[model samples]
Target chain A: MEFNASLIGQAITFAILVWFTMKFVWPPLTRMMDERAARIADGLAAADRAKQDLANAEKASADRLREAKQQAAELIAQAEKRAAQIVDEAKDQAKVEGDRLVKGAQSEIEQQVQSAREVLRQQVADLAVAGAEKILKQEIDAARHADLLASIKAEL
Target chain B: MAAEQSATDYIVHHLTHAGLVPKTGAIFNFSNMHLDTFWVALALGFLFAGLFGYVARKATSGVPGRLQNFVELIVEMVDTQIKDAFHGKSRVIGPLALTIFVWVFLMNAMDFLPVDLLPAIAQAIGYYGFGHDPHHVYLRVVPTADVNQTFALSLSVLIIIIGFSIKAKGLLGWFKELLTAPFHAEGLGMQIVLGPVNLAFQIIELLAKPISLSLRLFGNMYAGELIFILIALLPWWINWVLGTPWAIFHILVVTLQAFVFMMLTIVYLSMAVEDH
Candidate 1:
């Protein structure tokens, strides 16, 4: 239990050890631990951000899908209306064409009937003149009877 | 070996240190070196610093290895203690506390070794290699068992505490506080009368820190070592009956003493830096 040189010796050794620890041991380990803590915090923050982004993206996609569905429904309704309009126009055009064709056929038939009547009238007139000539047996002057033939033609 | 000597001689032999003996008329001379205490303490100090230094060099911010994890556990424990007790910013306290805790712990752990193992080896070496008597080669492996070693550390802490106090409050301020504190007076006459008393109390308080710090650790380790030696003197078969339980209980003492020393040093430093 004597105080001796070992006291000084141990003190020197103790000082050296403390110095070594302060210089080389404490700082690096402490820094690494702090750095690790910061890194973990950053990682957690990033994960939270990713989660938020994912939720936002999902909402955006859902909104776009709803808009697309709405647009598709509007387009279908417009196409159906256009198809009905086309069918109505076709029916109207077909009715107008049929009316024009019927009018033309009626007019043509009237003109042909008038021409046939004229032909028949002219033939009857010629037959009557021939009968009169046979019955008379005497030669009549044709140039002088022009007015009478015209009257007879008109009566027939 | 024990059959020849009395129990007293065996216990005294175990307590004796292998070192340079003091010369005549010089009981407390520096020439008297406790070689065992110095060497063992030096070795343990290096072991503590070197291992920590190596681990600190290789330490990473990423996932740590097993050794790194274990080292970090201890370093963090000490760091937390410092942060909790020490509010002032000083770079020295952290490492100092760590060194004290780990070095003292390792030194105290020397109690776990069989009491006669190191001494027997030293005896064999001295007998075969140096032609000395086997019983004369005394070696105590536990450095903390030595008052000199414990005092050396505590004295160093005391010096650091004084340095901190002076740094915090200048020398004049510190002296002024020493004379004025723990007994503030209302007037000049009361102050004059109380100043010396306060100064006396302050000196005793200052002296008490190192004394208590050194003696606590030294007493625990020394007593534990003595008990182990006494247990070793018992019959070989019965050794485990007492040895195992004592060793188990000593584990607590060893770690607790180290923790107490470190805590006290930090507390003292913190107290030094604060005004009364």
Candidate 2:
């Protein structure tokens, strides 16, 4: 049997191609893929960081809103307390003023009454003295006149 | 009687590999030696590597020359093919894809060399130097034309795929995948039939890998070599006229075969990663 040289030659060459290509070719190829994987991981980390930042912002905003709401309530309560205090002070001042006005009116009325009484007493005395002088044209006892005046005053 | 005996003898000899016949098992058959496979593949590998290096070194980064642009284009093509075929976290497949493309391309490109060039040179070297007969020297440059070489490549790819399958999915998990994947059917009766059917499909699929891989390469290269040999048989002057045209056209054929082989490898690796 004549075995062809071509078949033998072709077979030998193919084996080497497989050997070197596997050794040299596959390593660097895998490296590039690893780099790509690292890039994806970095991307995922960035996404995670962004999510965390968003959550932090949300929490911060909620805290601020709660604080603002609490302050608003406190401000409303303060305003109510101040208004009540002002109203109570005004009412107390009004009561004191009314009491003072009443006291002043009473004192003024007493003074006027005292002055009128004194004037009336002086007029009655003058009228009594004039009548006694007319009746007593002739000489009369001063003691007897005084006693009669006292009796008239007591009877009136 | 002599004619029938010669014909039978020819078929048996044709089947025998030109190697150091070993006296042992498949693993111990290191006696099957094929040196031309190494030499031609090495020669072409150096030739391609040199060409790429020379072109790249001479490139002006500002605006690439035609050769530089062409090299970049080839790289991009290889890279894009890699991206399309493999998925998830792969740290080894990209450069493997490129190397596969370049190595096979170089091997295939050997077909463009006058089918007689290396053999002619070997004959000359011996005829003049050692005074050995020119008729004794024989060499074939293309590797894929050899079925053994193609099968070797397929077997290597098979091992890698199996290795990754084991690595990505543990041994137990991978085995479980065979039992349960692609929709589960309940009950003892269904399991009895479907399990073996599924196992058989898996086996067939695995077997097809080397068969298809080897055959595809072998068919293309064997045809190309046959055509070149037929062309060489024409009158010497006429040989150049017809052979040169085919040689130029075959540049495309060789490159396409290499591309196909590499793409298929990537596809196989992609499949290995999938659960089904």
Among these predictions, the greatest DockQ belongs to 1
Candidate 2 regions exceeding 4 Å error are A1-156, B1-30, B48-68, B181-184
- DockQ-based CAPRI category assigned to the predicted complex of candidate 2: incorrect
lDDT per residue, candidate 1, A14-77, as tens digits? 9999999989999999999999999999999999999999999999999999999999999999
* Model 2: per-residue Cα lDDT over B52-136, one tens digit each: 5465445443445677667667766877787777884675565556656787777777787776577667668868988975544
Interface RMSD list for the candidates: 1.6, 8.1
What lDDT, from 0 to 1, does candidate 1 have? 0.90
DockQ metric for all predictions: 0.59, 0.05
Give the number of colliding residue pairs in candidate 2. 5
Off by over 4 Å in 1: A98-156, B1-6, B22-29
Q: Which 10 residues in a row give candidate 1 chain A its minimum summed lDDT?
A: A135-144
Q: How accurate locally is residue A77 in candidate 1, as Cα lDDT from 0 to 100?
A: 97
